[model samples]
Structures are given as structure tokens and as C-alpha cells.
Target chain A: MRVRTESILPYSLLAPTLIFITLLIVVPIFQAFLLAFQTADGEFTLTQFEKMIADTSFADALKFTFLLLIFIVPAQVVLALVMALLIHTRFKGHTFFLYIYALPLAISDLAAGIVWLAIFTERGFLNSGLFQLGLLERPFLFLSYQNLPALFSTLIIAESWRATAIVMVILLAGLQVIPRDYFEAADVFGANTLKRTLFVVLPLLRPSLQNALIIRTIFAFQTFAVVLALAGRVIPVLTGEAYNWYALNRNANIAAAYSTLVLIFTVIATVVYFRLLRTSTAEAGFD
Target chain B: MAGIQFQSIRKIFGKTLAANDVSLEIKDGEFMVLLGPSGCGKTTLLRCLAGLERVDGGRVLIGARDVTELAPRDRKIAMVFQSYAVFPHLTVFDNIAFGLQMQSRPRDEIKRRVEDGARLLELSDYLARYPAQLSGGQRQRVAVARAIVMQAAVLLMDEPLSNLDALLRLQMRAELKRLHQEIKATTIYVTHDQVEALSLGDRIAVMQNGRIVQCDAPMNIYDYPANKFVGGFIGTPPMNFLPGVVRVNEGKPIAAVGESHIAPSVALASALIEKNGQPILLGIRPENLALASAQHANTIRARVLVVEPLGSHKLLTVQVGAEISKVSVAPDQRVAPNDDVWLHFDPEKIRWMDAATGDAIHPG
Candidate 1:
């Protein structure tokens, strides 16, 4: 009886958290999967998936989302690397600069979109200042362009500014774990800055880089609020279009199909990333 | 290969002096150990010699070159850190080959030298393994192999054997000595262990508070210590110091402790007479003091406090007047607590120090 009581106590302690996760995460996921193959009257069918793939707006949104990813992921990673290096160098007022760089991390995606809107909108600060300097005859329309390149570049800027801090934090933690003796050893060996960074620093930081890449890509795939705030009715991302299908069009089946597609893409990306990283950093002893 | 000379080198960090006006000369092909307690600037001095740390005011000469302003690699020196500092990601083979590769040696020559170093250090079997996979001793040996392949004019080692177990430390120490003999490289070793310093160094520099108190052959440093600090630091069980005053008795000087007077040898008596009844501290080693039964001369009575038998020898702690003293005797000699015993010392082994200054009163 005592042993049974002890065993029961552990499960009882874990019951609340397990139940909460089932209600909040597991149930929703199961419901979405079920809803994806059902019609409006709840009859099982493949029509919703077929319709989702054939929709022209769905194709355009997928292309724009992939385009945003191509530009934003690289920009954020490079900017984060530079910011992390600057902080590691310990310049004067370094803490102040860290807080400034990390400020966007706390801002919501919707708030970030609004902030960028204040800069790139007509008669915004950037164009108004340019006009005051007599460099522009009128306020430039920076975000209203129909060209895909202009739209892609603006998305890259907003995402890079909003999300680079997460990568910086991971890289900073990696830099801190490296013993100073290795750097001193390199200096004694006459390895210059470039050699030290390439041979010592980069190899030691591989695990952190892998983690940052996986997390940033997952976040990029689910990006919705910022796209809605910036592009509104003019542009569509996967999440934004899913929201429109479920809430505006009242088509829960097609929305579930879009969610299933996003999940498939995210899983594939994560698996590919993990497999490549495992091969490249097998000897780093980072398990 | 050339000798290294530091002429009045000083290094100050903020308000604290890490090394102050330290002048030393390490002869070519000699293994010199800087021995001291922690924070004694031995490692700092070794780093300065390696050009890892710059001196505030002084000249550092390697052979005849003034290398004070030169970088570490340009100084043609290699260092083995206490942690071994093996590149974790690189295999042992690559670690040893790094220096040769940096010099842009031909691929064949680089392979040959790395293999030679691996053979010497007995690391050929482990060449394919990374540093994380090796044991502490194996990793340390890899660090040595890496330094040897460089063929630098000087090699600096900072307490390289300190992180190993007792058995491994002893084994590695002998291996290092053997390697140094074969290579005959000008080596500077830093350690806080007196046994390691005495066993490994051709000449040992004893440092205290960032200053070298004595630099000489190990035997001289042990036998003729320059001050109370050196006498206390260099020996196992350490040299025992007793506070006393020197006085003239029938034209012979004697050290008066509490109510007892210990007769001094002629050399010590004459040195004390020159000071004219000044207060002095007397130093005597535990091995120098014997049981009264086995004594030839200079015996004093005391009460035994404890007896520790250490197989070959017995150490007896005895109360002599107001101070306690340790005397070494043969293991067969037995004594109990509260037993009366007599302690004896050779008069010639008695050392005198100034009571106030702690400096040894050397014989003129």
C-alpha cells in the first residue's frame, strides 16, 4: 500500500501540467488534423486540401513567404553575429548598447510592424527628414510599391530588426563557455585574429549556431502579425491567409489544410537542419 | 638556442605589482624552475619570458636579441599551460603538426616531424584521437609533443604536472626530465612544489611576493637558505624556528630561549658576537635534531607531546622551554605521551636570523 501510494503521488504531482499541455497543445493539434480532411458538414473528404492547393492567393502567399525567408534568415544571422562580436569586445558603455540592441526583442511583432510603418510610411520620419534636407521633392512611398523586390526587402528589414536578438543571445552564451586559456594558447602560437576566430571560435560555437538556426527558421515560418500589420490586404503569408480562410471565409477545413502544410514544412526544415548539423559537428562533443 | 636574460623587469597591473624588478638569467640548454607559493609571480615571470605578458620597464634578451617588444611567436618560444591547452577539436596528429603547418613546412617534412614528436612522447597510438578523448596524462603529453615539434629556441611550462594524480605526476615529471635531457632545450618551468623544483630544475629561483628571494643550485638553496622565508619554504616538515636572544658566555656566544641556553658552534658564535647581544631567531631542521640517546653533543631536555612512526623514521614532537620542536629518530625508537626525552642538534647546522628583519645573519 505504501509503495502504491508513493507511485500514485508522483503522477498526481505531474497531473496538472500534463493535463494543461493536452488541453492547450495536443487537443488543438489533433483537432486541426481531423478538421483538414472534413467538409463543412463534417463529412470526410479530400476536397478542402485540393481547393487549398488550387487557390491562386494561396500560391502567391507561399511564394512571398519563401521570398521573405530567403532574405530575412541570412540578414538576421549576419546582423546577430556582428552584434554579438561587438558586445564580446567590451567597448565603453557596452551594457547600454546591449540593452539598446535587445530592445526589439521585447517588442511584439505587431508593435514592430507599427514602428517600421512610422519610418517607411509616406510623410514618415525618413522621408520627411530627406525632404527637409531638400534631398527629396516629396515624401517617398517606401512601402506602397507593387514590385516584389521592394516588398521582400522591407520584410527582411522588419524581421531582421525584430528577431536578431535571439541569435545574439545564443552566440553570446557559446562565447562565454569557451575557456580563456584557448585564446591565450592561440596568441602564443602566433595565430592572428582571423585564424583564432576560424579555427578556435567557430568550431566551439557550432552547437549554438545550429540551435539558433532551427529556432529562427521555425519562428520565420509562423510569422503572421507583422505581415498583416505591414502589408494588410495587399500581401499574404501562410499564417495570415489561414486566418482569413478560417475567420473571414468561415472555411475551417481549408484553414486546417494550410496549418497541416505549415507543420509539414516546419518538420522537414527542422529534420534537414538537424541531420546536416549532426554530420558537420559530430566531433564537437555537444550532445 | 640562446640564453634568456631579464634586466630589472617590472609588471604592474592597476595598483598591484604582479612582478617587480625581477632580474634573472636562464642559461642555454638549462632547465630552470621558478618555485614559489601561489601568487608569488612565478607564472607571471614565465608569461613575461614567453612574451605573453609585456613588461612595464625592462629589457628581455634572448641570446643577444632584445625581444622585449617582440610578439610571442616571433620570440621563437613555445609554452605548455597547466591545463595542457590542447586544441579540443583537433586530433593529436593535427595538434602536433600545427606549428609546422604555420611555418609552411613542406607536407612531407611536417608529417615527418609530427611523427617524430609522437614517437618521442609515445603518443603515436593516440594520434587519431581528439584531446577530449584522451586522459589527463595523455593530453598533457600531447601538449609536450606539440611544443617539441615547433623546435622553438625556448620552452616554457607553467605547472604542467599539477593537474595529474600523484602517480601520474611523478611519472610525467621523470618523462619531462628525460625529454629535456634529450632535447637540451632552454626551458623555464614554474611550479609551487618544492620537490618538483628540486628534482627537475638545474637551478631553482625561489620567489616571494613578486620578488626572487634566492636563485642558485637546488642544493645551495636548500642548505644555505638566504632568509627565514626560504628556510621555511624549501624543506619537507620545514626548518623549525625558535625565538631567542644571543649572549656572550665565557667569550662564546649562546642562544638563550626562555630559561635554556643552547651553545652555538664557533662559526655561528663569531657571527653572533659581531652583532653584540642582539635578539636573533635560530633555525634548525627536523632531521638535524636527534634523540638524546643517539646524540654526540648539544643536548637539551624536553617533554614528548606526540610520536608519529613513518616506517623508516619516527617524528617526535617535544616541548623545549616555551616552544615545541620536532625531532626525527629511527623508527625503532619508541616514546609515549608525557614522557621525558632529550633533543640534540649539530651545532654547525644552527642558523641565525635577525629577530626584527628575518634575514639570515651570514658568517663573514
Candidate 2:
């Protein structure tokens, strides 16, 4: 068969992306797998995994990571859904509210972390405000290692404030595609607001919920910048342990093991989300 | 089960007046159709009745109870939307049972009602299917079934047939009439379609801008339209209108044409005698005017412009002086374009409209 110029043109156009992915992404991931399984002399061994399991913060990292994932994902999803629905109502000055809600999307994770850190630190705005309000005689240490739950909560709030906008945007798109007649039908059929939200709105929003869940969960699994900036070593996460192993201790193999574990968790999370928020092709707008 | 009254209803949407002091009474089991073109407030009026729209001022009564301040869910009304808003995620049975479930009815009663509704809508076989699995007509049936299962006091439909194809629309229109006959719910249906209004409405309420122009039975609305706008809006191959003068010729009231004049009957002359040489609009339906064999006292000369051969009849577009008029003629009528013709007025069928206000003036 003769290769047609038209077909050749398509592959030529695709070459740049294919080459870039193979070199930058595919090659690095392959090297990470190899490094995770190799010893210092480049010989294959299980020593990295053994070392990763033996590390003091490894179990803490996994537990805290799961804790953050369990708490933050639901908080962001609920918050974003509410914001999206409120915006969809098109009330007076809804555009202004939408703008305010999406403003944090442009913020870097580190920037958001630092910003929240200032508010949660001992002499930060929250403690200062509490002192001024006569609720506290002095600044309170809200981000101390003595209280892990407090530290965990600050991480969840800061992360949610930074990341919920993307999910809301996805949900807003989903909401817009839903015809206004459905809500009117619900009202006419005597479905109250809560019932309508539970039955009509949520069912229609499955594809978006699926997407938001997978993306946010994967982001939770891989997140390190915000965690480090806010909680540091006190609330050690998987990615932070990986970072500490690779950059501080100069151990790429152990870091690769931690990273490989993060990948596994992300894959598991994505699969779980796909199962939980499953939408038929019909509901996903295919038919 | 109950009647509806919109007592001096007024609704304002931002700067646009959607319903301007619209007051109407709909009897129990009466199928009242609010008929008008888009932006004429027909749908707005229906929404206000269904409690979907808030009236800035006025009261809405379902039977004797005032429901103007009620929420839509509390209004005891069910509606079928134009888009056939069947819950896409739900099975046909579940969709139909939604309202019954909302009412917290017994499970068995909900099942019985849904099954009955499905059978009524011919959706019994597709109870397990989702809306996406059904055709447009079937989905609309699901919407109808959903409404019917509730058995509310009032059933409001907002252009429900508008989304269907032409053949499906015709099919649904007949089915809706049949359903109304069987159920006898006090229904308020809104549409821009005149045929639906004429066929389905017990009383057709023709609206314009934000006011009801006329409300009457279908035939009465078609045969005796209250205004020129109502007449024109409700018919095809519309009423022929000529701007002419009512003059007294030989002491008899005659409408002056280009050079000739057509005199009214002896009965009509008595009514027009009071106002001589008054400018009036002479209106007649195409079917009411005939091609005269020769020029007579009741005939005006014209030239045939176009002869469109319809299956049942030939429609002749003729030029009368500077004005054009449509005349429905026998299909075998030997008339060609540019042929000279004389139009004979059916004196009894002529409608005289006020030249300025467009209101019907039944002279005699």
C-alpha cells in the first residue's frame, strides 16, 4: 500500500507530541520504576522497598495521606457543588460571586499554603483577631505538633480553599448543560428543594462528579508543596517523605519507591471514583 | 376538580410587562388554552396560574382557595414542559412515580398509580427504560404520564407539543384531547399554535402584548374573532382586507371600490346608514369571496395574479386596484394569471372592522 500524503501529514503533525511524551514522561516513568527496584550499584534488589517500609515516617506518611484524602475530597466536592449551584441560580451579582470563587484557582499551591500558614501560625491573623476579640489573652499555637488534629484540619482547609474552584468549574459546566425545564418539572411535581437536589441535580451531575473526584483525589495523592509550606515535618505526607528521601538524604531509589506507591494510590483512587460515580453513556451525553 | 381565577393578575419581568392586569376565570374540567405568538404573555399567564411565576400584584384562586402566595409544590398542580423534562437518569416507572413518592404515598398506591399512568400513555412496555432509550414522542408520553399520575387539581402544559416532529405533534394533539376528555382536569395549556388552540381548547383565549383579546369557543373564535389581530393570527390564507369607504349611494349604504362600489344587504344598510362616507376595513375570508361571472352591484373587478392549485381547491391571488386579496375558488375554475375577474361579495359573510382600532363592527 502506498502511503498517502494526507495520512503522512497527520503523523507529521503528531510527531512533536509523541516524541516529547516519550522523552520527558514515558522515559522518566520507566527510569523511576527501574530505580525503585535497583540497589546502589544498579543491580536489581528489594532493599529500597524494605528501607521505605522501615522508615519512621513511612507509616505516618501513608496514614496522614489517607486521612487527608478521606477528609479533603469530600469537603472540596461539597463546597464546590454548593458554589456551582448558587452560581447557576443567577441571582443578583452572581457573576461577582463567581469571580470571587474562581480567584484562588490562579494561586500557586505554595502561595496558598503560605497565605493560610500566616493565618494559622501562633502570631497570625486568626490568633491576633482572637486576642483582640478578648477570646484569648495571648496568641494561640494552632499549628503545633502537640495537636495533630488541629494541624490536619488546617491542611484540609488550606487545600480545599485552593483546589475547590476546578471542581466547581466542572460542575458548573454540567449544571449549564442541564435544561432549566427539569427543575421546573420538579417544582410542578411537588419536589421540594432538598429532594430536587438529591434526585434531579445530583443524578444529572454524575459525569462531572466522577471527573472532579478522580482529579481531586489524584491531586491529593501527589500533593506536597502546600503540605510542606503549611505543616512541614509535623504532618508528614507520602510525597513529602519522597521529597525528603530524594532531596535531603540523596536516596533516589527510596524516593522512587515512595513515588511508585503514590502512583499506586492514585490509580486505586481513580478506579474507585470511576466505580462510585459511574454514568452510563446516555447520561454522559453520548446518546 | 376545581376552577381557577386570575384576579387582576399583574406580573412584571424587569422592565417588560409580562402580564398586564390579566384577569380570567377558568371553569372546572374546562380545557382553557392561552394562545398567542411568542412574547405575547401566553406562557407567562400559564406560569402564573401554575404558581411557577410570581404575580407582582393580584390573586390566583384554585377553586375558592387563594394560591397566589403558594410555592409551586404546594399549589397542587402538575405540568408537562415543552422539552419533555423526563428525568433522564430514571426508569420510565420511576419517573412516573416521582410525584407520588414526593407526596409520601404508600408504596403499593404509588405502583398502582404509575402502572395506570403508563398504561394510559401507552408506555406500559417501556417501564424499565430510561428517557434516552425512548423516542421524542415516548419521552413526551413519559412526561404526560408523570403529570397524570399525580392527578392534581390543575394540569399546566407549556407548549408540550412544540418539541415533537410534525406527525408526532398531530398524534400527541389528538391524544391530549382524548386524555383531557377522560381525565377532565381543569387544564391551562399554553401554545403559539392556533390549530392546537382551536382543536383542544374548550375556550380559546387569544392574547396580545400582555392582554387577552378574546376568549370563546373554538368555532366562535374562528368565525367571530373579536379583533383584526385575532382573525389574522388564527387563520391561514388570511382574511382579505380592503381599505374602503362606507358611502350612501341612492340612499343605500355601499362600500366604494376603485371605480365600482359593492352595496351591503338591506339589513346591513340599516346599520351603516348612521355613518356615511366613513373609512372602514372591509374584511372577508378567502372562502367567503367568489369570482363573479360579470360585474354587478355587489361585484368589484380585479385581475388574477397567481393561481395556486391546492388539492381540494384553487387559491387565486387577485389584484383589486392597488390592494391584493386571496380568493378560494373551485379547483377546476378556469382562471389564469393576468385574467380579468370580478369578485362578488358575500354580503352576509363580510366583517367590517373599525379603521383605526381594528375592532369588529358587525354592521347589521
TM-score winner: 2
Q: What is the lDDT of residue A180 in candidate 1?
A: 73
Ten-residue segment with the worst summed lDDT in candidate 2 chain B?
Answer: B262-271
TM-score of 1: 0.91
**Residue A178 Cα positional deviation in candidate 2, in Å, after optimal superposition:** 1.4
Interface RMSD for each of the candidates: 2.7, 2.4
Model 2 misplacement above 4 A: A1-31, A37-47, A281-287, B265-271
The complex in candidate 1 yields a DockQ of 0.40
Q: Please report how far candidate 1 places residue A5 from its true position, in Å.
A: 12
Number of the top-ranking candidate, with DockQ as the measure: 2
lDDT of 2 by residue, B1-364 (tens): 8999998889999998989999999999999999998999998988888778889988999999999999999989999988888998998999999999989999999999999999999999999887888889999999999998899989999999999999999999999999999999999999999999999999999999999999999988887788889888887777888878888867778788778787766666777877687888888889988998798767889999999999899999999999999999999989999999899988877777778889887655
